[model samples]
Target: MDNTAKSAAILNGRLAEETTRRFTERTFRIFNDADHLSHLASKWKNVAADKAQGHMFEQLETIKFNYDALRKDSELFAKTTASMVLGTDPVDIIISDGKKTLREVQAKSCNHAAASTFALSDKKYAEMMRLSPSDQHAEIEKLLKQRIAAGTLKAGDYEQTLRNLKKDLQYDNVSSGGTTYQQATEATNQSVADRVADEFRVKSALTDMHESGKRAGNMGAAVAGGISAISEGFALFKGEKELGEVTVNIVLASAKGYATGYAVTALSKGVTHTASYYLGTGVASTLARSNAPVAIASGVVNASKSMIAFMQGEIDAEQLSDEISHTAITSTASFYYGAVGQAIIPIPVVGALVGAGVGYFIGNMIHQSGLLALGDSAVVKAAKAHRKQVEAMCLAAIPEIQRHRHEMEQMLSQHFAERKAHFTDAFSAMDAALYEWEPDNFMTGLTVINDQFGGVLPFKNFSEFDAFMKSDEALEF
Candidate 1:
């Protein structure tokens, strides 16, 4: 292929791969949201249903905010956690952007019939009144530690709460809004019914974000695929392919691009997500949200191709091994390059793409150079193998060839002796007939000659032969 064709193929492949990765990543996040919601429901089972649901919405909104912030600045890290401190801490959720506290949310759910208002729980007020200041501080710290041990809070949460406690235990914010419940149901069901609409809104917004991301990825991939097809068409045309052939080539290329894109993207996402358990969400999110997945997908694709080639006998085991090693090393380089690129450019996908592309090129170049260096040795090894094979074949044929030669010699010697005896006998008979005028001897010589000439004589005896020779037919001959 020419440079133009090569470039087109590369572009098409990269675009397809990237498009697929983005789509799959978005899809994964959508499912992740569902899982998160389920976990939250289970975790907050002891809390009032309405309160738990409202808190869930609050947490999701915070998550949505963090996602938006990260898009604007990758370096900015934001997260939300449900506050688990005991004794009416007033803070239902904590929000941070990794550097400092952004907000401490006190979420309250109330139906329209009850009131569009909220206040600190009675328990909190009582504690504030009953406990001395120092004792209150100590008790709050003790509760924070207990919450941490019970898996209700993290170390970060513990630290943030302690910091707040040291600063006079102030509640930052309260989240209460007019809900959709117009008529008051039973007191128990009123809050739940009122917040139902709000819960839907929050969930829908998050879902829409995921869907939007997926659609964008799909659209980008489609554009890339179209461009790829056009490039391929031009390449095929330059090579003087027929119109039909060019069309077929373009279609096949497109189909393959899409198939590979989806397959590799899904595989890479699955691997990354599974690894996230060990890597932590921050590190995992960085990988998933960036083009590092592309590097992983690329390696997987190359490895798959190598395995297929080996199975089809197009590559030997040694070559397959080399390819696997090359893919692993190149992929690692690509991933690191992509990560660095993300850091430097911090423009989401673009930076990662540029870095990964450069890394792949460099890695491939090194591999190719190594192959070239070993080319002579490989050729010499092949030549030696071929020579040995030829020698073995010759050795195998020697015994059979000797057997055939011996048989031919025996047959030829026996035939020569038999011919010599027959010739001597015929000549003696002829000489006797010619010198001594013996008719019987002449007849015998003629018979021998006839037999040697394949027995074409018509007469069976001398009397019949003499009668025919004296007839008019004999005179005509």
Candidate 2:
């Protein structure tokens, strides 16, 4: 048995009853019926979808009739276990397809597209914005004091303010700078005290303001220093002004203080603009492959993972459409055992064939997918042998592949966690008012991630700020 089928059998055992009900019920029902049992022995096939493979069955009765084969079997489990022992990368399914089909399915060429953001060294952004966290910390402390004064928070607000200030200041030198959080906080506190003290003894408001000209000076100095360093360091990608706009885009939050937070939200909601956002410079430019190519390959890889997860989620989808499906695990019998029962499952020739041989031969006939089966295949054995040819390659690639898979899985987990919270807010934000949406941009607004503070900040572009914030509570403050 193939790993997929083995995994499927494992999944059937481990799968949540409700999950099966929710996703694959339609396909399940079709294979599980009784009448189709006799006809199941014929040649079987699958329709290749743009993104995934389709599961088919002879009929419901055949599926219902031969519950033993479809159910997880020890022999099937052992076969899959042995395959894994030999070592195989699940992703090789697609890679083999690319190799055989002579297409861009596996190894894709990378190009530079501006939209997919690269992880760049923003040491300059950090160094220039070094004073920002401290300034914001001071501002937060003062605001905390005011909140306390207004009785907005409990008396413990002082300690909370100090704690938050201390925490916020730690990230200042994350990329660069010598000052510690405590040191920065102390500096900001001193300026805050000087500004407040000046307010107390001064007679004229202008004099007091002048005495506190320091705060504006600090903010201005921060901004000016940032701009100057940014210019000198050339931190941003230099691209055509009209075609690609450089942005030190500030994401202001409702929190009592100012801190730029540009959290990466889900790409599922991001605009699929067809252009390279980066001009191929710095580390981004130095990448072995062009960013555009990396992104396209990454997209294909991302889609593959997404499709597997989608299919898993739909394991029980057959229940929904009342479809039943079966596997081609072959079992043999003698004359003494044969007369007792024939596996009268759906396609007669197919069911008989499935019983006589492994799923590989019959499934191959239907889909012409050599990639799907490899138990006795030359191609698979060669790949496995080549992997062993390099001692380090076998050890390194397999574990690394597994590790990377887990890492991508974790990334997706984080992405979905963030996505659910955002979509929840979005649906809540629109509520009954969502019905007012129109193509002319009347009541409905773009749902793009224009702003970085929170949620899917919707807009075709960052051209409209007022419209983007009109709904989000996170943005409201």
Candidate 3:
């Protein structure tokens, strides 16, 4: 790497960083919904401009009319009803006009219907609703006792309390339960709550899960916001679209259709250097991209700028999948200097070795770390662990099988992020090497770096990653 190229490399790195910063700062709106994209939204307005649009508008008008009519009709004729599950009445309604009293069934229908919906009318109905305890008529008391004895009414407990119940019937030696109004009310409330809880099967575990998910979802919004800002910042900075020089031309990712974005550049033809090694981040401000945050957001970025955010975020999802770490990663800037550096190097064989330079970089990268790529043995353990862990997570879900779903999700978060970050690093590292660090005697460099010991790397650390894949070992609530 010559001084001029180093300067150019640094400058190009700064430009890439500027692109990423612009991307982040420009996107990540908290209130913004990610699912909404201009491509989709634009279609809605475009309908009116074409034959399709005009037809859509007419259809929409009909739908709008139907909606309004349906709502109006529902409001006019329908009653807003909630489930009113009453514990079978302990006492029957009584009727009295300060004179004779009569026992009434526990219902609210009158002899005649009224025009007002949800409201009943009939002087007899009005008179029946206002019965007082003093009315204490004998006939009502007899019916109440008969109903209780016959088990026609399931709960006599509430009606038995003389103090708690406001009755129109006289208790001719009928009031014998020691109950007060307040106690009766409390018991009633408790009974209702118990019934409701039973109906929904609302146990503690489900409650906790629901709340945890809700909280995580809320926090995820903040995460989403932060991601958006970083995305936008990168975009804004890269608005100039100054094409970067191809520093390393690694194997074109013939990765079947869509595995693109694998080119690299070290030295922009015209730019001033500011640092020892400038690292290119991502483009696309406001990115609706695959979660490649590990590549641009962590130690993978300008290793010199900030490591904590990138590193933490990289491993964040690795906890989800270890490939995250294996595929995408961090390597020194010196590790991937391709043709551009060779261009500036001007070492004895310049034009004679033009094709060889690119070829050598690719072959060396493949022989080295690239051999330990995604499907490699090192990543096998982590991958298996992640698969089983996720499967165990789903399998354990049933008629309330496992209690520690939280722990499962945590494990998921760690492994998923790990896998994502790992792959991001690995794949990117290949390109970086091809373009940024074209080492002399590529094969020697590959062999030296290939077998070297590193963090037992998440890809190789399978035991802990896949420890919980059995039903027998599952946690109990």
Candidate 4:
């Protein structure tokens, strides 16, 4: 295929991918929320359960962020397990680039602002040594302060420096194998300190991720803009669009997409919130936990887009109506299918996502088929053919029209310059005659004036000049 066709195909594919991903992502989130509700109902009173819930939330967030990064940005590959075996792995998540490990992430949902109060232990200290140097230093400082407060070490006994403390504790750089009594004690202290630092890091990461996720409209806008830019870039490469047009299109598309996404998200949330007040928490929560909101939001956004396109004269009224109807039907189908999917699959979130996806796919296929049938109609075909003919004729005449315009401009400019020069010369001569009061100067002025009239002056002497002035053939006053 040509670049034009290829670029169009890729753009369409991207649009489809975005729609599917949005639906499925929203579906999964709803189910995840439902799971949280179930937990709250059953184990709300248990402190341990609350802790477990927090941990699970952190883990899920980490997995989701990594998964999105991989899918959207094509970043490093992450090996994530839904279930983790306790004591089997020290890290909560491992990230690689297909060839080598990039990072070992330890997820924690603890409050970062709180001071570490866990007692120092030998095994913990050893683990602290495995962390980066900055982390190790920070942990050691905290531990030393704790020990000093407890009166285990005199304030003057050791300098607060990491090097001094390590030396005094008989600490070695080794992470594994043979441990002395002093080393073990120091290691134990370091481990507890390490926990404090690790929690801080995890919490910091989670906070940033949460903040980013909360700006869903901005993210959606960016994604849409980026996709448009890529598509336009392809067109630029194919000489189908100029740089200025592409830039403007990208900016406008981003702004429009952002407004639509933001409005839809806000409106959907508002509707759900308002419903909760009237329907009670239980009913509202159930409604909030379903795919209906996502479907409705998507449909509204799509319909708005169609309306905009129609207003811009990009589509006819019939096409606009069809698009709105298609969006409504598809959205309705997906919402109901999601419920059926959950019932059939008996999985927490997987079934709903799969079912909604299937529903959307079927709806889209039918919509496209209907559009194709409409396009093949006689009136539509004739309109298209007429448009093509007009476009071809315009293209053919453009060069000739431009050529004529350029020639006319040049001719007008030349004529203007010539006339201006003649007027300037005549005026200057007349001024010189008036100032000098001499026959030679007057004659020069008259000669210049005669030249202006194509040398048509009829007299050379005073008598002929008087007769010429008196005669009807003379120039009118």
| Predicted structure with the largest lDDT when compared to the true one | 1
**Model 2 quality (TM-score):** 0.14
Candidates in descending lDDT order: 1, 4, 3, 2
Off by over 4 Å in 4: 1-214, 308-315, 338-355, 369-477
lDDT of 1 by residue, 1-477 (tens): 122222232333345445444333433443344345445555666777555545454434434443443233222322334433343455554555446765554433343211212122222322221111221334455665665577742444444444444211122231121222221122124344335433433443344334333433454346446766777778776986677776776666556545554444445555555545457445766666554555666567667877998999998887776666667666766667766776888875677667766766765566555543223233445777899999999999999999999999999999878877887899898898889987667778778877766775566556877898888784433
Candidate 2 runs further than 4 Å off = 1-388, 432-445, 448-477
Q: Give the TM-score of candidate 4.
A: 0.33
Residues 340-420, candidate 4: write the lDDT tens digits.
877899875667766776666665555555553323333455678899999999999999999999999999999878878
Worst 10 residues of 4 by lDDT: 167-176
Clashing pairs in 4: 121-188, 122-188, 124-191, 125-187, 125-191
lDDT of 4 at 434: 76
Candidate 3: segments with Cα more than 4 A from true spot: 1-204, 240-477
Q: Is candidate 1 or candidate 3 better by lDDT?
A: 1
Give the per-residue lDDT digits (tens) of candidate 3, residues 119-201.
Answer: 21122333223222222323334444554567643224313421222232222222212212222122223333234223222
lDDT of each: 0.50, 0.27, 0.29, 0.48
- The lDDT of model 2 is 0.27
Score residue 233 of candidate 3 by CA lDDT.
45
| TM-score of candidate 3 relative to the true fold | 0.16
